[model samples]
Target: MMLAILIICSQITIPLPGVPLTLQTFAIGMIATMLPLRDCLLIIFTYLLIGSVGLPVFANFAGGLPILLSPLGGYLIGFLIYGLITSGILGLTSRSSLTICLANFLGAASQLIIGGLWLIPANHLTLSQAMTIGVIPFIIPGILKLFLVVIVAQRLLKARLLAR
Candidate 1:
């Protein structure tokens, strides 16, 4: 069910220059908060594997190895990294809103860093140019997503709709 939600979220794309804006990070945040660390990693890895095998599970319904080889590929891999970090944080910390918010922020930062680094070599861009396109535009939206994730996860936990 969570994997399906992620796939749907991944399809909700606003195409940008190289990386398309999607609800993936938001869904990832929620998944990391709600599921156990091993389960969260499994879901993320499964999503990546499905997309890598050409199942149209990526942004704009893109799939296959080519999608994984594209400039935006690192962001896809970043999802796994983000899930790992967020899940680890959730495991170690209390499930307060602040904790979730911090975890999501850190996860977003990791994604931005990895994606920016990959963009530099893949797109033949300078660090400034990569940051300009890959990281800058996403920061605000990422924060907004973090806020939403924190609120929603808190509510879900309070309502007993989601596991801690």
Candidate 2:
């Protein structure tokens, strides 16, 4: 189910020059928030592995080693970092609203930063150019996505409590 969500999220994209905007980070944050660190890692890695094996699972239904090694690939790597940090935080500490928001924000920021940095060399872009195209464009949207992830995570937790 989570894997399906990830794939679906990837398909929803707004094209940009360097990196297209997608809800992948939002889905990843939710997965990390809902699952243990290891499980979250497994899910993220599985998604990447499937994409690496030439599945049309990435944004715009495109996936291959070329996509993984493309300029936008750092965001994919950031997804792994995102799962680790976000899931590790939720696992190591209390699962409160504050923690959830903080962890998700950190994960999102890390992803954007890594992706922006990757653009510098991969696309022969300067730091300013990378920030302009890669990082700055996503800041506001990332925040919105972070809030959405938090809300969904809280609701899921509440539903689970109610179920129990």
Candidate 3:
């Protein structure tokens, strides 16, 4: 149920090119913290596959090969990394709110870093330019999403889904 919701949430976008803010990363982090690592990775991979096959499962209500080849591709790739870190962290720790929050925070940071690094090189953005356009506007939202992911993860964990 949660997996289905997350995948659909991933496709919701805010209509920005290369920067359509979506809950996919948050969902990934939350799922990672709640599910076992292998299941998390599989679900994330499947989500990506669904988008890659020309489905309108990406930003701007757009998908297909073109969107994948666009500038946002790097961030799309980074989603997988997001799952690995957050879920891996959750897997390593005993279930707790703080642990889940920390894992989501780190996962969010990793996603931001991955996006910034990829954007700089792909778009020929200098550090200052990239920081200005990519990282700065996102910090607050990212923090909020981190908090939300943590809350959701803890809720799922409390429901005894962590061991499933």
Best TM-score among the predictions, by candidate number: 2
For candidate 2, lDDT tens digit of each residue in 110-156? 98899899998899999999899899989999999999988999999
Candidate 3, residue 78: Cα displacement in angstroms equals 0.8
> RMSD (Cα, Å) of candidate 2?
0.8
**TM-score (C-alpha, index-matched) for candidate 1:** 0.95
**CA deviation > 4 Å runs, candidate 2:** none
In order of appearance, the predictions have TM-scores of 0.95, 0.98, 0.87
Give the 10-residue window scoring lowest on summed lDDT in candidate 1: 155-164
- TM-score quality measure for candidate 3: 0.87
| Ranking of all candidate structures by their TM-score, best first | 2, 1, 3
Candidate achieving the largest lDDT: 2
Please estimate how well model 1 matches the true structure, expressed as its whole-model Cα lDDT. 0.89
lDDT of 2: 0.91
Q: Indicate whether candidate 1 or candidate 3 has the larger lDDT.
A: 1
Q: Write the per-residue lDDT of candidate 1 for residues 88-129, one digit (tens) a residue.
A: 999999999889888888987998789887898899999999
In Å, residue 23's CA in model 3 sits off its true spot by: 1.7
